[model samples]
Target: MTQGSARTDLRIGQLNVAEGPAFEEFYEIFCEALPASERKPRELIVALATRSDYYLLIGEIGGRVMSFAILYLSDRYPIALLEYLGTSAAARGKGLGAEMFRAAIDRIGSDSLVIEVDSDRQDSGDLEMRRRRKQFYARLGARQIPGVEYRMPKIGADSPPELDLMVRPGGGRTHVTKDEMAAWIEDIFRGAYHRAVPREELARMIQAMPSHVDLIP
Candidate 1:
């Protein structure tokens, strides 16, 4: 079913992931905007879309596809993970991305929505780009969790990518401590990303994280 919102011109709905020409084109465009590692093969995304825990939302403006968002609902908690969000090249600089984000939050009905942002890295030269990305989310009301340190698993021998955790907590969101947050974050890595975090590695990551509960203002 197509969902409508009066606040914007874009119409949001689920992407048809069935094997077909239209889906192929849509996925191709979406994948082009993302990194090679982040872009999954067609078969995997097709299977994921059929699962109850995953959602694929597309936003179209005047019949033109403009943005897409993938969300995952955790099996252990009533939390939604904003797995990936991207906008068509032509649609950048407009407010479509932010609108799509707010729509995802509204549709999921989850008070706490978690998003992973790449942390500044010395080897990677896109420090300003990374900062801008996080700022965009912050402007949309998402707050970075203080003291959280996340490292993305190595992709094909490249260094283990580091990331930061941010969340937009709605009215019914529960207040969790550092430990609880770490567990939830780990659950996302294991459940959504399918990466097993060893006990020792988990301990190390948690140790690197701050124990404070402050939110980015």
Candidate 2:
């Protein structure tokens, strides 16, 4: 279907366990789109699905699923981590990804949303792809968390994984101080990543961020 028609016929909602076909499609497509090192095991996906904080949303057009988004919402705060978002290759470049994102941000009221992007690394040759990915989010009004050296925990044996934390204002203006950044880091580590960030590492990460900074746009 065309982009305009897809938007007109679009339907977005949580991907519950009962939606077997949709969920399977999402998983299969996600596996194809993401690298093995970056992808999570199917069991983990199932486990996270049972939790209230984790959300898996499926976007469908005329009853056929086309995209998926995985979000982790903080129970104590109005913040969310956009874990993964993907559209089937056949349906890409037709605004499905952006449409699903807009719906998600609107649904969550975008108080504070965090997403990770690959950092520029000399050895990693996908620098341009990473930059374009950042630019895509920038177009969506998300900005990099300035002055922070964020290191994503190694997932699937990839050592020294690095990522840039990007934030965006959803409902209102935002002021991200060091303490707030710390809180975000803590929550993401424990809640989303399912691992505790070491105190020293956390301290270093927080220290890299300025004592106070505003990333709202």
Candidate 3:
């Protein structure tokens, strides 16, 4: 997809291979935009691009890569996880992030897209930055899924970071049922995390979910 305006002309699409200049450019921005704790090893990320269910979307302008998004499509569920998204420092403040997000959703064509954001409830990092990130998604129609504490799967030896799970419902939906949310979570734990998360831990998290999860602003 392509979006053109006075300030930017962005062309976004999926990158199937993990090599070449575009992939290299995407990786450069990925490493720079996301902290070590929040990202997986370079090899593992590259491997995911080879999978049928995973998509690596890249956005560029005038043939220069400037942004990317990693989307995980669950085979057993009608949901996709927005695993990682980043815009190069040089491309910041040009509304590329939001455009990339919408392009990802459009490419996946899923009824729901789940994203993980740093939690304000915990001192994960810069609180103000976290607030701004949440607000950014909010403006794009994503809302927090309250009553549950969400965490990213552990990267290497580091413990998982607490994050807020927000969902953007498509097809004119307003909420997700408990069962649907539970399945999506389990799919994420198994498909996306490759069952790296312990079964007992997964059970505990699901057990704490509310019956009806309303996306709240």
Best by lDDT: 3
How many clashes in each structure?
0, 1, 0
TM-score of each: 0.87, 0.89, 0.89
Against the reference, the lDDT scores of all candidates come to 0.75, 0.78, 0.81
1-217 per-residue lDDT for model 1 (tens digits): 4688654577888887663654665686678777765566567778878889888888877776678888888888767888888888887888878878988888778557889888764457888989899999999878887656676665443454678878887655535467877778778877777888776767766675566564434
Off by over 4 Å in 2: 1-6, 121-123
Worst 10 residues of 2 by lDDT: 1-10
The better candidate by lDDT, 1 or 2, is 2
True-structure RMSD for candidate 1? 2.4
Q: What is the C-alpha RMSD of each candidate to the true structure, in Å?
A: 2.4, 3.0, 2.5
Model 2 scores a TM of 0.89
Candidate 3 stretches greater than 4 Å from native: 1-8, 16-19, 196-199, 203-208
CA lDDT for candidate 2: 0.78
Cα deviation of 106 in candidate 1 (Å)?
0.9
- Provide the clash count, candidate 2: 1
- For residues 1-217, what per-residue lDDT tens digits would candidate 2 score against the true structure? 1233236777788777777887788788788777766677798888887998887877888677888788888876668988888888889888888887776686577567888777764457788888888888889888888767788777776564577888876667567778888888888888888899999998887676788777764
Best by TM-score: 2
* Global local distance difference test of model 1: 0.75
**Candidate 1, superposed: residue stretches over 4 Å from native:** 6-8, 19-22, 121-123, 154-160
Model 2 lDDT, residue 110, Cα: 50
Q: Which pairs of residues collide in model 2?
A: 110-170
